[model samples]
Target: MRTLAAIVLICTATAPQAHPHIFIDTGLTAIVDDAGALQAVKVTWAYDAFYSLLITEDYGLDPDGNAVLTPDEEAQLRGFDMQWIEGFDGDLVARLDGGSLELSRPRDVTLVMREGRLVTTHVRDVAGTPAMAGHILSMKPFDPTYYTSYDVTMNVRVQGLEGCAIVRNLPDLDAGMQQLQGALTKLGRDQDAIEEGFPEVGEAFATEVEITCADR
Candidate 1:
């Protein structure tokens, strides 16, 4: 499991600056059934080179020094678990109408090295209510503590929606940084400062995904 402490050890920089220790370019695709009802979300996370190196070292991948993963290595890579952190919720948040949508443990997990960087792909079922026939669902993936930074450089895609459109509300980084500063200031140097302020202030820094359903 990847932890903040591991990142801190490798990066040697945490807190005060809040410069994201780990960087991931993210992509989201809405999975739809044959009848066009949204069933799940497929998320792709490509990690930066620096963090990729760290993960590679931690996982003991490519032990042969040939840069090719063995069958066991591949199994380990595919078995990387990412479940919600109890009360803290998970890094990805999805909501339909006024209620929050539950996400099953990540499935179809895959890990590969692309251009010397680590890329992971996985799908999470939209638990609770799955048929999003006529409702708008909003989603965002972010660490409320402002720990790891996520960026989406490409256009967010919607699969199986021939006529529906996608509208993305990108995060305002400047305003978000200011919000972080305020939260840090209020919490002072307490140990739990970032974690405590995250629930209230984290989403401000997340890229918003609002899917507008096509007319019935």
Candidate 2:
């Protein structure tokens, strides 16, 4: 994984041509209680081949380069990405009725190499059950700094809930690109953009998932 400082350097050095260094295919499974309330969410991330290779080499795994991990190697790889710094939200945001939903730290982490890519899954329990029928539940997995790009291209399901449908809203790349260019132009004018911060344009490119439930 790239450091925050490194991400800043890349963005500043590239300026108007900012691009993601890491790409991930993301999946989400929303868990619901018998009472039709959200209980937890299971997130799955499949890293791209380049980043997977970096991780494998960094951890000194797959010494044979066959992309296969032994039991001990898998054990060592588990939770390798869970060592998050403070204020990191694991690149996931859940909202109910336009307010943020608190999510517990990731648990039940699993890691494996799938088709030469590093795939991992973890479960994040909702801090409290939020009823689904009367409220809208929205989720987005993103990196605010835009150094890492997340694509919600996998299965999205709601378990233990009936009459709930998931809606996906993809970002408008044309508009998002224009917005990013404008922001970069402004940043270029400011000599302190690197020290200040890169524009948080990840959300602009994210795919939002919303859950709507029918009333009983």
- Which regions of candidate 2 deviate over 4 angstroms? 1-17, 186-196
Q: lDDT by residue for model 1 over 102-156, one digit each (tens)?
A: 8777788888777767778888887643565577778888876656776655457
Q: Which is the leading candidate under TM-score?
A: 2
RMSD of each candidate?
5.2, 4.6
Structural similarity to truth (TM-score) of each candidate: 0.76, 0.87
Across residues 1-216, which tens digit of lDDT does each residue of candidate 2 receive?
A: 223324434654657445567888899998988888889999999998889999999989999998878878888999988888888999999999889999988999999888888899999999878888867889999988776888888899888888878899988766766666667778554345447676788788788999888876
Error of 2 at 90 (Å): 1.2
lDDT (Cα, 0-100) at 107 in candidate 2: 96
